[model samples]
Target chain A: MKKKILCVCLISVIYSLVFSACTKDVDFNQINDFEVSPVVESSLIFLNEPANKFYNNGVELTTFQDSVAIKIFKDKFIKDHLVKAELVFETSNSIDRGFNLRVDFLTDTNTLQHTFNFSVPASPTNSVLIYNYTEVFEGNELLSLLATEKLLFTLNLQPGEAINESTLGSIQLKSKGIFYLNIDNTL
Target chain B: MKKYLGFILYLACVIGFSQNKQILYGFSEIPQSLLQNPGGKVDNNWYFGIPLFSHIHANAGASGVSTYDLFADDGVDFNSKLESIVYDLKPNDFFTINQQHEIFSGGFAYGPSYNKNEYISFGLYQELDAIVYFPKDYAVLVYEGNQNNINRPFSLDHLNGVAELISVLHVGYNKKVNERFTFGVRGKIYSSIINLRSLNNNGTFITKPGDNNVYDHIFDLDLSLETSGLVNLTEKTDFEPNDLTKQILLGGNLGLGVDLGFTHQIDKQWYLDGSLLDIGFIRHSKNIESYELKGDYIFEGINPFFPEVGSGQTADEYWTEIEEEFEDLFTIDTVKTKYTTLRPIKLNASINYAFGEKLDKECDCTSEDSEYLNRVGLQLYAIKRPRLPQVALTAYYYRRLFNGLNIKATYTLDSYSFSNIGLGMSAQLGGLNFYIMADNFLEYNNIYDAQSVSLQLGFNYIFN
Candidate 1:
């Protein structure tokens, strides 16, 4: 009787073990892929003029100067406040360009101002540069002020270049703003 | 929401009954015997029965994590570096980030029979979870040009919670033929309910300039900038506080299930058992929303010059434009869903030995009493405390106190899960025999954390 009981227990044990082992093992390999569906909401801006610069007199705008100036304005209902903006430029042909730029906002008048200056790369080929900026409307400052308002800008673009009216081509201001250079033909 | 309220009222009404118990609906087999013998009316036939009849029969319990308890304390508070730059700006200056609100829940299980072949049972369970955090003060700031500008201030103070109720029904049967062979099976049914809710708060404020602190922005800009009076003229206005509102959500699902078990006694002293459970899924209804926003802000104190409109615009018109321009600012069609419970299926198998005489051979006694357990012998079967992998040995010492009463204590260890110690008695009176058992002698497992505990009362009627 003892032997029979032992045999039955042993057989059952072995059978259960074999069955459990034969069953599928838990797969712990994690296969996860993060697909950030590109938000159609975000925008990408491109400059039509690759160089984004001009020449004045016998000098180039790439030369360092005291300051530079430009006019800015909001295009119709497209309100643009200076939330955050930066100027990005790259040097080519091993030419070095050194400069600085300062920014200011005239909230009451709804205009942003640039009173600083900076030099661009003096590379022979056309170099690309960008001024990136952003602004957030706070309180009713925006709702009431911008219900149907236009944002404008006044920049001081100073360089050792030969300043002229046609030196910078048609003021291709990406934003609803104007650009200008103070230079005389007599000089 | 009305239906949910009605159901809650109904539950309150049911629980109001003094006799209403914390009923476990899963294991109905073991308790059947106890319910029948509560007044102890057994006599005669039970005296000739084996003491082993007093073996334990059932247990019910619950176990799981608290999603609400863990998540409720997650409110957010906003802090800004710009505030630090402005020396006059106090720590309370920045607007807050929205609070984190969510609901989570876990489940339970109950077992009613130890000697699987003799019982059937039922169990019921429920859970409620509520957790959310409210941010104090914080807001997002966008930089235009090189200056800091404040956007609309919004810190969501939302509410989210979930409640669940589940009912399970089960039945098991056991029979021994001749002297050794025994077989059994169990059937089950399940049903459940889930409720959840969400709310939102929105506001606006203006930025002010001025600092009374030593490490203010004016100081930092001057030190790093080397330009005196660079921010001497920099100015901002104080914030004007405004309105707050909320929103609500509703949704749920249901399900069905079945389970079967079997046991066999290979010999007079050896037995084997196994079972499968929860083989089904719960279905749910799609979610639906039912509220909208209702307030606005006035910026007079901050901007004394700017005009303020009291109530010319409707919430709809404002929100529509806000959604069109800055859709990310406000969450539209936010949903809170009840997660589906994933019940894992279980299979059980065990071998047991009875300490009595080997009933394999024929008995010579002809007396009616001798023909019963007397022929098989009256030795007690004591339960074993240790668990030996693959093989578990259990015994009970049965003592017959009266003509129809037999008492015994049982100890069992389900190697796959945990062990159980049980105590109970069986009484037989002619055609009606009843047994009652309370498992876990010393509370190795309780109504909460233990592996499993159950009370089983069973009934058996044999035809001559």
Candidate 2:
């Protein structure tokens, strides 16, 4: 009886050890129920005042000299496969003439990397008219721009016709960039 | 948005599921079995738990969605997966988390050896119990905006849960009145170190198309978060673990409780047992704090003419005014008030039939005095909850494989799953006793697919 009891004890211990070791390993794929998309937005406004005037013979507006910086793509996970970037310009013009708007993407040293331009029709009655324009960058161009930590944007507004000093017009430019990410499972 | 995502991840890590240990109920002669049924039969005179190594349990589960439901290898975008969770889940579906850890436990019985009818048993164990029910409505309101579900009222009735860290000191009396009836009653003194509860919340959030604006949102909220032994943490930035540990030992709230149980022999081959455990309440008076929000508000999109640039005011100023007005509408009131919380009472009943050969083959004792070596039984278990009592039914088989080795297998049906199989084993070698048990065995290979899973293991020293 003693020998039989000892054999049963040994068998039970072996069985428990084997059962515990057979459990499956945990992986990222097993817990991939949710995903996150981070979007960063920034806006810049230019007012036609004494410091920044509107010219009559289509003069290039130099008031948009300050560069806006992009800081959301610094994380390695986001910068590795940066998918898309969207730049939107909403202008509220009180002037009576149409104008041309130009935007530039530049480096820290002011080297132009990309440029986009669009035309905004003049307001019908100077009641703060709003015009919206959007530009999207994807694939290779987005990935290349995300390689750098710092981003610079420059904007210029060229009046189509001469304007009186008293006739004031303003442009509001908004930019929003969304980063899409896919994390791979190691196990 | 990033902050919300981080908070969700944090919640996922902290919340766990409740494990109903149906297999461990009346499984063997292990001293811990008495916790489930105070009148359970035991052949040993005394048992000593191995300090922290005794009675460790952990479980986690979801009733509405499993990990596979949200995080499978399917070719779907992350946003679409989240939308399905919000729209596809039923309103009654809930996520439950429960966990218990026994710090130290042991039991001993004493009486006249000649009188086999009466005995007195005493034991002390420190335990931590926590359970939280997921608020599905709140999750939907937070994840998906009210734009899609226009005019639909989202209720806050699902936000209910309780957590407690306490130690129990108990003494029980077991008496055999006759050849067919045995009864037991245990008196318990509970010393609770920490307690937190949120229940009976009533509120609604609705949004409808507005006449003057794009959308009009309405809120009617009445909710509170109450706590004890945690008010000091909010006042102090730095605290030592030793101080907190000392407080947990004796400086917290107190309460009383009792457990009643009985065992009856129907004949030479059948038996019945029933128990009601933890019928008690704790008075939370020490450092109590309650944060409540009760109010109603309506917001039609911010006035388009506010902070007019035409009047020389900036858009930033307009946004600041909106923020201030919103804060004024919903203000949280912090008060110090005493409250009471009842324990989640549990009930168990079982009927068994004994038939296999007795382990003590040489003993010439009658059927009434000698114990059977094998048994088959069915058990029913239920625990009180905020809305309703949760229940489970189980059928089990028990066998003695050898002189000191016993094993049990169980099949259970509960809210989480209809096919939950469990296994338990208790072995004794010399004076050392050890036991291990686990439930939902079919999901062991792919745990992520399972809605509920639990495991418990412990060690003790016993002598007959």
TM-score per candidate, chains pooled: 0.31, 0.69
Relative to the unseen true structure, what is the Cα RMSD of model 1? 22.8
Going through the candidates in order, what is chain B's TM-score? 0.34, 0.86
Per-residue CA lDDT of model 2 for B27-120, tens digit only, reads: 6467777777777665677777788777777777777677766665566664677667766765445566555666666666665676556655
Per-model DockQ against the true two-chain complex: 0.02, 0.09
Model 1 chain B worst lDDT run, 10 consecutive residues: B219-228
Clashes of each: 87, 6
In the order shown, the chain A TM-scores of the predictions are 0.25, 0.58
| Weakest lDDT window of 10 consecutive positions for candidate 2 chain A | A42-51
* Alpha-carbon shift of residue A65 in model 1 (angstroms): 18
